[model samples]
Target chain A: MAEISFQLLLLQLMTGLALGAIYALLAVGLSLIFGMLTVVNFAHGAFFMVGAFLGVYFLGLTGSFWFSLVLTPLAVGAIGLLCERFLVRPLYGRGIDYPLLLTFGLSYVMIESMRVLFGLEGVPTSVPAELKGVVDLGIGSFPTYRLFLIVATAVIIGALWLFIEKTRYGLIIRAGSRDPEIVRILGVDIARVWLIVFGIGTAIAGLSGLLAAPTRAVNAEMGIPVLAESFVVTVVGGMGSLPGAVVAGLLVGVVFSMTSLFAPEYAELSIFVLMAVVLLVRPQGLFGKAGLMG
Target chain B: MSNAILSVRDLNAWYDRSHVVQGISFDVNAGEVVTLMGRNGAGKTSTLRSIMGMLDKRAGSVVFNGQEILATPAFSRFHAGLAFVPEDRRIVPGLTVRENLQLGLIASRARDTTDAMIDEIAQTFPRLKERLSQEGTSLSGGEQQMLAIARAMMAKPRMILMDEPSEGVMPVLVDEMFELFARMKRNGVTILLVEQNVERALSITDRAYILDQGRIVHQGTAAELLADDEIQSKYCAV
Candidate 1:
């Protein structure tokens, strides 16, 4: 039997971080939308799945990984705008559950449509040449793609933080998160902000798909499991807190990694179990505000 | 007088069918200081919210500066020269004082405004000048209130709906806030203040409306309401 050792733990940590990077990206979008628009957007996972396929389709057309990387998200973001404008916009200022149900229905429709075209089997993707090799780690070899994934997550998070903190539009999003009424009173057509936020959220989901496409087999139902996991990440972090999502993503990733080590089959069950534990303890998740729970 | 700057007639509002403001009507004339005064839950805040389109559900006509504005969205109302200073201050807590003011300017038709106006108002609210580089959350309550008003001032609005300018501040700050309002009035910015502080509300306002159960129960000049012991005790007494 392979005894648990420091190197093994280190490997798990690295593995967890890689997984966490993807979860963090996906959850950030969901948290932001909930924060500003109070919409659950159940279709968020479907968008992620759609993005992966988007990469497959775009790469087939352009034969360039980089081109697909940029365009897939933009395409997904545009679709997100249509979703928000047509379905989510009407449900604003109403009970949040409205968007939850509406987006849930949308997710079903989107997934079914993709199924009719792509079939149920997962599609394969190749790692771009630049990211295909393994870099020698002092302890063990690390895939260059995994390193790229880490750096990509960092760069994306940093850019998003800068956009929300330094730019004028960022101020509106932050303000809108707290009190959309005030955002409007300042004379911004908040509807536009909502559209932008929805686009950005879906774009992030798309990016997650593109990032993971080379690592895993993509399929019509691929977004479903990730969707459930991202929701867990978002809720455990906080419904609308970006910081909350990052922390929760890291926590969830590490937990799942460790669980797979102890009991491989239990890895799937670990996420739900942890979510239950969090709700039992903090109730509002880690960074989530208590007063806002109602 | 010049068709009144903002006029509301028989406005009814709801928060998902929970009637909050029922058939309330009041008007703010051009460059006038009007107020809606009542106890908490008496619908003074809701009335202002209804006029600003912040109420979840509201009905009846709201005319602003000769235009029918009842159906207008909140941001559009700002473009038509109306501004609303929320009850909670709603200062962008993470932003610097200047940034918060800049955000307010940018939110509306920013093309017409300039940083020079920010500098000018920053001069008026000296507290804001001192805190210009500080995060909005770092300021004291009074300073936050000043930042809120200074932000609105940057937009150069024709009218502002100020909700409880005196709430949640020090007495000295409250006095200074009223003084600031007086200064704003002299500058010809139309205002509609909503306050539970009847004495202070009456002191600064030309006319006052007493709201109760979402309806207009009393309407008269500020001085007249101040003298009426019965109205003050029954409706607006703290």
Candidate 2:
């Protein structure tokens, strides 16, 4: 029993890291949007679902997985831009209630529209030829695709970090999050900055969806549970801290996976439990700056 | 439009429903250092904010460099050669001192073609040169004030509206700030300064405007305001 449990723990650890990559990608985008516009972005999961759908369709159209991988997120990002300009922009500074409601409504529209078109059946996305195998890691065997997810997520996050820290425009984004008015006074077209940020954020969510579609069943309702989990990660990591999102993502994933190892029935509930514990102790989150949400 | 660097006429400003500045007018001509003197709650800060287009509700005409910019947005005003150094400094968190200065250069009305402005500002503020990599908010109160002014200068603005640059600063730094203002004036940057330090402000500025309860009670040469005891006592509390 002990040997079996140890083997399960190792396997689950690998599973948790890949799951954490997905959560990190989604939560980071959510955090970016929150950081810039202070909008909760309830439609983010819908964007993810749409990206998965777009990925499947694009693969069908071009007969090329690579093209689908590149194009889907761009399409979703454009959709996000439209959402911001038409639906969300008017509600800015009127307090958070209107944006929150608008996004919730948008998420409903996206999911229902997809359901109408694609039905409630789960669509299986074929794994790419390059990633269609398992790797023997001495202790256990892990899917090569899952390892790819972990690596790809890391590369994308590294690029994001470099963009925010090394580039001049990135500086504006960081500074704008702290005090947008000052950024405007400094002469940046803050509206354009926000539009681009919103687009990038939603695009990341879409990318996460596309990446995850191969592992999970692609259905209209696929994003619902993930959305709940992403929110828990966001709140646990702190509202707008990028590093917080990452660490908290991995931590939540590991906890959930570990819980499943022993108490499979309690796996899903473990995330909320961890969130409550973290909030009770450090309300600002591990990396969140104080007074941002309060 | 008037030929002044900045011209304000009958400016009234409010803070979201509460009218703060009522029927005030002022102008800063080319190459002149102008100061607005008033007591606490005298709407001096409101007047500066109105000029910057930072207030939500502001009425009347404000012309900069021969164009009326009352309808222009706050950011466009900066592009139109207006810069405001707010009282609180507003040093952005998570940025180094150098990065903060770089933001000023990026936001300027005209691009710094040579990118020599940063070096020039560093030379002017030697203390800033030493702490270029330090976090902006980690600086001392006086250093942050210096950073604010230097950041404004990085824009190479034709005109700057500075509000209470001396607050929370040590006395020695206050002297350094005044000296820097004098240097800024000598370099042909038009300035409109708001301050509670009546004596220090009057000494550096060419002209002075005294605001009391949202109105300009006195506008004259700095020497004239300094010489007048009653106006000083009534409006400035000096």
Candidate 3:
């Protein structure tokens, strides 16, 4: 009984980490957009769903998951670019509420459009052949795809960190996030920066969705749950903080997975519970600096 | 007029409903350091902001480099060789001093010379040379002011609109800043300065405009303004 319980614990921990990885990716994207543009992206989940759908569609056309992985984010990012230019650009300096409401409405439009195009049925996606199966560790067996998810998220997040810390454009993004007017006066076309930031944010969402496709049923309403969870993650991690998102995502995931093992019904509820507890302890969230957005 | 690098005429600005800068006109010639001196709320800052295209509700004829640029955006103004150093010295948080300096070159064609420019800036501002990796906001007020000015110089702009560079700085550092401005002036960079330090300002300035209630009350050469005690006592006692 002890041996079985230990193995179960390890399995649950691994699964939890995989789930956290996805949440981190989604939350990081949301935080990045909010940090730079000061616009809470309500349509982030919809972008995730779009990414999955695009991935599935691309896979079907090319019969290659790798192609889908590489192309989906680019395609979805282009869509994000258009959305920013047409929808988000006009609302800048009008305060945050306008963009919030706009993105809220945009989420509905994107969801309904997907419903119309793909129908209400949940489209199934298959795991790539190489990633399909289990990897036997010394202590236990774990799904290979879940491991890949964890590794891939780490790599992507690492690259993003380096980009933000090392590159010149990244420097502008950081400075612009603090005060765009200063950046503008310094000679950078801040409008273009906003557009590109929006693209990158949604592209990250799209990649998360593609990663989630094989694990979850791909449907119009699929983003709704993940979106809620990601918001919870964002709040728990402290809104608009990248590192906070990452740590909070993994913590929420582990809590969620551990709860599922003991009581399946409380698994979903556990994430909110963790958020509430974190909020009670630290109102600004785990790593959030107060008055940052204000 | 042809030699004037920045010329503002019939300029008016409003913040929301309050009409702040009312029909102010000023000129800063090429390779000249001009001071805009006035009491608090006299709209000296507003005039510079309007010229930089930072003020939204502004209408004016601001000619720079022989072109009318009242309609141009703020970034484009910078691209056209106009730079601004705001009074507050907005050093971006979470970015290193090096990264902050790099922001000055972000949208300029002079980005290719980033390393050389940074090296030159480091040599000029020795206080910031060792703190390049430190977070910009962590620097002292004097160091931050220097960082702000150094960042502006990275673009190698033809002219700079400086707002109160010596405000809230230590006495020694204030002298250092004025000395740096003198060096910059010698390098042929035109400057339009808005300062509360009237005595120091006139010392470095070739010409000066004294603003009273959003209008140019007194305009003269620095020597003439220094000698005329009546105008100085009325508009620039502070």
Candidate 4:
């Protein structure tokens, strides 16, 4: 019994980390949009969903998963630009709840439209030949695809950190995240900054969808569940704190992975429990700073 | 010196229907540092906001450089050679001093201001050069004020609308601000300075407007306003 429990812990940890990578990416994207535009981005899940759908269709037709990987996010990002130009721009200064609703409504549109085309069914995506097979860790044998996913997430995240902290444009993003009004005074078109951020954020969400498509059964409903999970991780980690999201993602992932050991039924709710505790402990989130936006 | 760069006529503004700026009017001429003087809530701030068209709703005829500019949006107004620095200071806390200054030049893309042009402005505010890499919010009250002025000058606007440059600054720094405004005047940038310090305002401005209860109660050469104790006692005095 003890050996079985230990093995379960190990397997869940591996599984959770992979899912957590996707969640962390989604949370980071959500936070980026919030940091720049002050919008909660309820449409995020829809963007993620779009990435997955595009990944499957494009990869299957072109027989190039990598090509789909590059195109899907950029295409979704363009859609995001249009969304900002039309729906989001008009809603600026109208308060947080308004954009939240607007994105939320937009989410349904994106999902239903995809649903109408694809029908309500789950689609399975196979791993490419290059990433297939097993990677042997000292404890056990893990799929190479899972290992690749983890490494890819790390590299992408590392690149993002550098882009945000090191580059000149990154500095603007960080400044805008901390203070958009100040960003404006320095003569930056606040709208232009917002548009870039919106594009990058939706692109990240798209990437999350593309990355997850192979691992999970793809369906229109896939995005909604991941969206809820990502928000749980975001709230748990700290809203608008990039590092916090990373930590929270890992923590939530581990907890969920561990909880499933005892009961798969309660696995989903474990992160929410952690979220409630985090909220109780730190209302501003782990790294959230107040008045930065106002 | 008396070429009016910016002028407002019968300007009325609102924050969602409550009238804040009640048809007040004034003029700022080229290369002149004119102070908008008032107590708190006297509409001095709104007048400046209206000049930049920052208000959500407003009715007025604003003419900048002889062109009627009442229809211009806040973002477009920068193209018309107007700059606004708000009371909050609005320094991006994480961005270095150089980044803050460069943004003004980058955003405007005006002829006089570029990244290299900002370096020239940096020479004028040596404190900025010393702390070029320092995050803007990290600067002291005086240094941040200097940075704000430097960033504003990146555009080298025909005029600058500065809201309350003296407020929240320490006593020692207050005098330095006066000297900077003086230097700015020498550089040929028309400036509209808002201040609570009546004596300083009178001394710094070429011309002055004393706003009382959302209206201009007095307007004259700075010396004339200083000598009139009745206007001083009623409106300018603490």
Candidate ordering by DockQ (highest first): 3, 2, 1, 4
Residue A107 of model 2 has an lDDT of 97
Query: What clash pairs does model 4 have?
Result: A186-B103, A186-B104, A187-B107
B70-143, model 1: which lDDT tens digit per residue? Answer: 78877888788888888888887557787788877886556346577877887688778787888987888877
User: What tens digits encode model 4's per-residue C-alpha lDDT throughout A1-294?
Assistant: 345765556866887787788888898898888877889999999999999998888888888988887888898899999999888999999899999999999999999988898888956788887889997776688888877777878888899999988776887787777766656545566788788889989999998899988888889888888889888877876678888778787778778877887777898888888888888987666777653432
Evaluate candidate 1 and give its CAPRI docking class based on DockQ.
Answer: medium
How much lDDT does each candidate structure score?
0.86, 0.88, 0.92, 0.81
What order do you get sorting by TM-score, best first?
A: 3, 2, 4, 1
When sorted by lDDT, best at the front, the candidate numbers are 3, 2, 1, 4
DockQ of each: 0.67, 0.78, 0.87, 0.49
Q: What is the iRMS for every candidate structure? A: 1.5, 1.1, 0.9, 2.3
Every model: Cα RMSD to truth:
3.0, 1.8, 1.5, 2.6
**True-vs-predicted CA distance for residue A291, candidate 2, Å:** 2.4
Name the lDDT value of residue A20 in candidate 4. 82
Q: Model 3, A3: alpha-carbon shift in Å? A: 8.5
Residue B96's lDDT within candidate 4 is 83
- List ranges where model 2 is wrong by over 4 Å: A5-7, B108-115
What shift in Å separates residue A34 of candidate 2 from its native position after superposition?
0.8
Candidate achieving the largest DockQ: 3
- Score chain B of each candidate by TM-score: 0.95, 0.94, 0.98, 0.93
Best by lDDT, which number?
3
Which pairs, if any, clash in model 3?
Answer: none
TM-score of 2: 0.96
TM-score, each model? Answer: 0.89, 0.96, 0.98, 0.92
